[model samples]
Target: MSDLYLSMGRKEGAAGSLYWAIQFTNTATTACALRGYPGVSALDTSHHQIGPAATHSGSSYGTVTLAPAHSASAIARTTNGPVGGPCLRTGSYLRIYPPGSRSAALVPAPWKTCSGIFQVGPVNVDGTF
Candidate 1:
């Protein structure tokens, strides 16, 4: 449950693909979850949401569900490459959540809650979570 890095926040063009990586340490015993999703936009504060691309942190050229004690993992390169102007280049973030299989009070959202949460990245703007 320590030394973790959930690499996310990659952007692409419309219907395009993206890439990123995730790494960790001292967590081979407990399975930790790294939630990759869009953060509050630096340009548009009123629109904290998904957008121009499709699968924002997904399963197939999208998000990643990292296993605990996994140490490190590098995401594949993206298909969309880059998009918009650098300002609209898109920004992503990562949240570290753990398994909620035996917990309560947590909603257990896939890539949001962090508990019983799943990895999602090479993020997109469509907000698939």
Candidate 2:
């Protein structure tokens, strides 16, 4: 997935939920298509997986196509309450995999996450916030 670049947008919050917009840009010269939910999870400073993988929270998913220099996005949410029990850990990074992709990208994120109950939406075409 070197042809694609992954980036996170500003965080938005309402009620008791925190939301993040994950953007995937096609940096190559050609267009590409992405479908389903992107794999997402917290990571320890050592790069090991932490907590349960983010669960799919949205309804049905649809294919997201991107043209060169264009982008697609997905939304991820986390609760304000502490996660996990006494073993609750702070994550130093976030590991992400685009829809139908095996390769992944590591994003720096300082967050305390529980070992359960992570949530993420399905990938959507460009301009989706």
Candidate 3:
């Protein structure tokens, strides 16, 4: 599995958010899922790029399953919120794996993550690895 990070620009005075899209090539024979709905991350500039806002959801998007040998994509749109997690939106982050391959930590914490510095979720977040 792999991770990608994006730094977005808000529409002036609009709350900053995370908008992501994942494109993957099917390498496994079995069906797979591009997981990411309702993802949660607390406010920690040192750890997470996008900080928690008074109104955020778990994940911005998710794809239940993908056909084998087929290429697909998913999008996530994140925002700042109180509790729980982000909700499904146009853009989102996705992590894909073969049937039941999700382990304790499918994806690692982005080593070079973003800082809660800007309004668009985070500014110049580099920890997409």
Every candidate's lDDT: 0.32, 0.78, 0.32
Model 1 Cα lDDT, one tens digit per residue, 1-129: 334533333333335443333333334555544334322111123333323222233444333444564543433223443243222333233333322222211111112211111223432224332
| Lowest lDDT block of 10, candidate 2 | 79-88
Order the candidates by TM-score, highest first — what do you get?
Answer: 2, 3, 1
- Candidate closest to the true structure, highest lDDT: 2
**lDDT: the better of candidates 2 and 3:** 2
Q: How much RMSD separates candidate 2 from the native structure?
A: 2.5
lDDT of 2 by residue, 9-104 (tens): 778766656678888899989889888888999899899888788888866777877899998888877765544433348788889998888999
For candidate 3, give the lDDT of residue 10.
Answer: 23
Q: Give the deviation of candidate 1 from the true structure as CA RMSD.
A: 11.1
Q: Could you give candidate 3's per-residue lDDT for residues 39-118 as a string of tens digits?
A: 32322333333333212222233354546665543333434332244332211222223222443122332211123321
RMSD of each: 11.1, 2.5, 11.1
Supply the global lDDT for candidate 3: 0.32
Pitting candidate 1 against candidate 2, the one with the higher TM-score is 2
